[model samples]
Target: MQAGCTGCRSKADTFDIAMAFQPIVDAETGRPFAYEALVRGSNGEGAYDVLSQVTPENRYAFDQQCRVTAIELAVAAGIIDTGARLSINFLPNAVYSPVACIQLTLKTARATGFPPDRLIFEFTENEEMADTSHVKTIVETYRKMGFATAIDDFGAGHAGLGLLAKFQTDLIKLDMDLIRGVDTSLPRRMIIESVVRLCENLGITVIAEGIETVAEYEALRAIGVRYIQGYLLARPGFRTLPEITLPGGSIAAAA
Candidate 1:
């Protein structure tokens, strides 16, 4: 095993980190559907500041720490009281074994009083996977454990459709590149509309990420985008859950 994998399994920490939460809003009700826990420096620095320190020997430990710390902080932030899911990013490559690696996460969740079913483990599609079969195993295992699974930055990665074909995740996050200026780009609208339709058919929820303006929000809402996460709704609140500011007159979708 690599040195990092060994430390990852041990989950011994040599770094100090913190979390920032960004809410993913329900387009219909304008309520927070979930809060994604983004990593940051303990002093509230940007993600890059903390991520830049990660090395091969600490990749596993970093990944494990992220899960425990996010859950612990979210509980302190009262996320469970809001009835929103806690969405956490996980590294597939760092996982030595799904069942073995998840013990710490399970313990943290229990200790923090966060329900296991309300957790969402998200994996970025952009990260190259040396073993896709292992990725599938992680996703499936998480699903069976009552936690939701999501693919982040869906269309930006090479694995796009191929990953979807291999694993049936609960959610797919549309890359910011696809959402940027989507209100003005006919090609973008058409492509997004098609993707929405496909995901709807697949029983997978789609979340439009990186929304920053009313025009973009309105455009996505008009096209039946059900969930959204971005600055237009709220920015990541470092070590806190920032108040969500939804666009005015945002109506709930019909039941």
Candidate 2:
């Protein structure tokens, strides 16, 4: 097994799972800034694949382990500072086992001296939320414990908008699909503009993903979307972090 495979063999049988951080930048700035940790799996071919093929019952377990490993790697690599934040995505169902995951995360953070306040949990809105009340309770518990919460893929999920209204999210990642051609598509542009406005009104920060063109970047910036993550700026990979340069060419290190 590779160095990062902690729970791959014990719980979900054999699989090669790894975690990599994708830098999220301030749209105005071109610098590589905040890192969004992503999980990938390999089937002995030495190539990483999406974890979606795992059985639903075991996927959460694998994901939680990936979160732990990702944080560990970041700390070891010195990519994350005591005050700098790291974002990790989770499925809605993972909240059902919030306590266990929380305990593990806290343990790993303590071991690496990574501050709990610098950790953000991003819940993907793609899956059907099994129980909203339970999820709300779980999110509230984590919030009180000093972890930031975010809703991922906001514009393409079943409960995307509804979840945003119900939960107090520190961040909302705009679905890439919704943003792909937003620069030229009037209808899509309008939808994104409205969502951006709504998020601003709610005092929530918005992050536009899958940005691959200068036009898309400019359009998103014009509409007041602040943070962005996509191939246009930087592909997700392991390397020395890059300085983020704003649209106007002002560069700054990650805070």
Candidate 3:
């Protein structure tokens, strides 16, 4: 697992970026299970505005800075008060050395007094893996370091059942494509239910993401997706924790 934590030129590139946090709520309790840190331009531009600046020469810097920024911003947003975990997206290809790259994150967590265990590092399946073995090493090393790992956008892009055959993460977020109209689409409902059951059997939790309406939320809850994220709960809070809207038509502010 730790074998791939080598060969890297740690460098920093000059660029401006920030984070917007969106909550992932618990279906049963209507409380935030975690807050996912999304990349944004310093002036509050969307991810594309920031990602467009990434090049092979600066990918490492962007990835490193993202981790540091997410931790600092989440702590500032009072995540500790909510007792919810902080989930940050990472680019596997950019990670030249998982162990080496995480040193700054560990340092930042310590500086902010954030519990290491409350941090989850997730990689999206949308990003194709040039080396599956490298990604697996990163995941295993992260878990061993007591940080939870997740596969984002499961069942979309290059991420699907085939990838799961190699290894399983702590959580998998169902792609919005599958959850878009789950309430009315029988095919989607069946697919979601099957995925939920498969995750259960594999001891991995499932989170239905990109939900937009009451109907979508209700259907996901019925399908046993305990962790939910999307517009229905709350939009991304720029430099603040947004309030969560419960299934019963009540808003619970993140503390």
Candidate 4:
């Protein structure tokens, strides 16, 4: 179904599906680790599109499909078990929908025999949130329902530490920019270190995103960042879990 770009024009029916991988490490070991699921789309012309364009009304539908497809693919490949968590992104507006995306997620988990705790919803930082009070209520509600919540691209936008304080997030993914020059910039390292300390004090886990080099990985590890995701680890693809291994002989499928 084609949707109007502006006004009421129609668009294409095909939505592309591509996967991006983010490493989820063992909090204690700081190792190359389990991969999180990312969804992407391609227009019929072969250009990749930003997921944000999908209307909030349709965002959950698209993302939930990706989650289910990823899980089914993993299961058919005999990789991921019902025990593994599948992290998916959700737009803020989805939170306001009467059928909140969280409910769809819980349903998917139940149908697949995946524990609710095994599903993590990563909300983007770019969208304008509806109401902080309502957002926090939804987040806490999800947590109480056994699902984990994370603020994607945490340090990249105005959300900053304020959102961290407001929401009881289970994970905070550091922006890629912070991870890129971390090995050389003392100030950057120090900033991340302080955030790490703050998150630690709050009992929230920190993840360093876009680590494309050994230097970056080691630098993040040194600063107490436990999780890392980047090209150096593994690129996102359709393969099942446990099929890929990390630098230390750790398997992504094992997660």
For 219-248, candidate 4 gives per-residue lDDT tens digits of 888887777666666666544443344556
- Winner on TM-score between 1 and 3 is 3
lDDT of 3: 0.88
Local distance difference test scores for all models? 0.88, 0.72, 0.88, 0.63
What's the C-alpha lDDT at position 222 in model 1? 96
Q: Is candidate 1 or candidate 4 better by TM-score?
A: 1
Per-residue lDDT of model 1, residues 45-124, tens digit only: 88898889987667888899999999999999888888889999998889978888888899999898999999999999
**lDDT string, candidate 2, 193-225, tens digits:** 999888888888888988888889889988888
**In model 3, which runs have C-alpha deviations exceeding 4 angstroms?**
1-12
Q: Per-residue CA lDDT of candidate 3, range 1-255, in tens? A: 242332223454756988999999987878899999999998999999899998866777788889999999999989999999999999899886777888989999999999999999999999989998889998999999999999999989885998898988999999999899899999999999999999999999898899999999988888888999999889999988999988667998787
Off by over 4 Å in 1: 1-6, 249-255
Ten-residue segment with the worst summed lDDT in candidate 2? 1-10
Candidate 2 positional error at 76, Å? 2.6
Q: How many Å off is the CA of 155 in candidate 4?
A: 1.0
User: What's the number of clashes in each of the models?
Assistant: 0, 10, 0, 6
Ranking, TM-score, top scorer first: 3, 1, 2, 4
Better of 1 and 2 by lDDT: 1
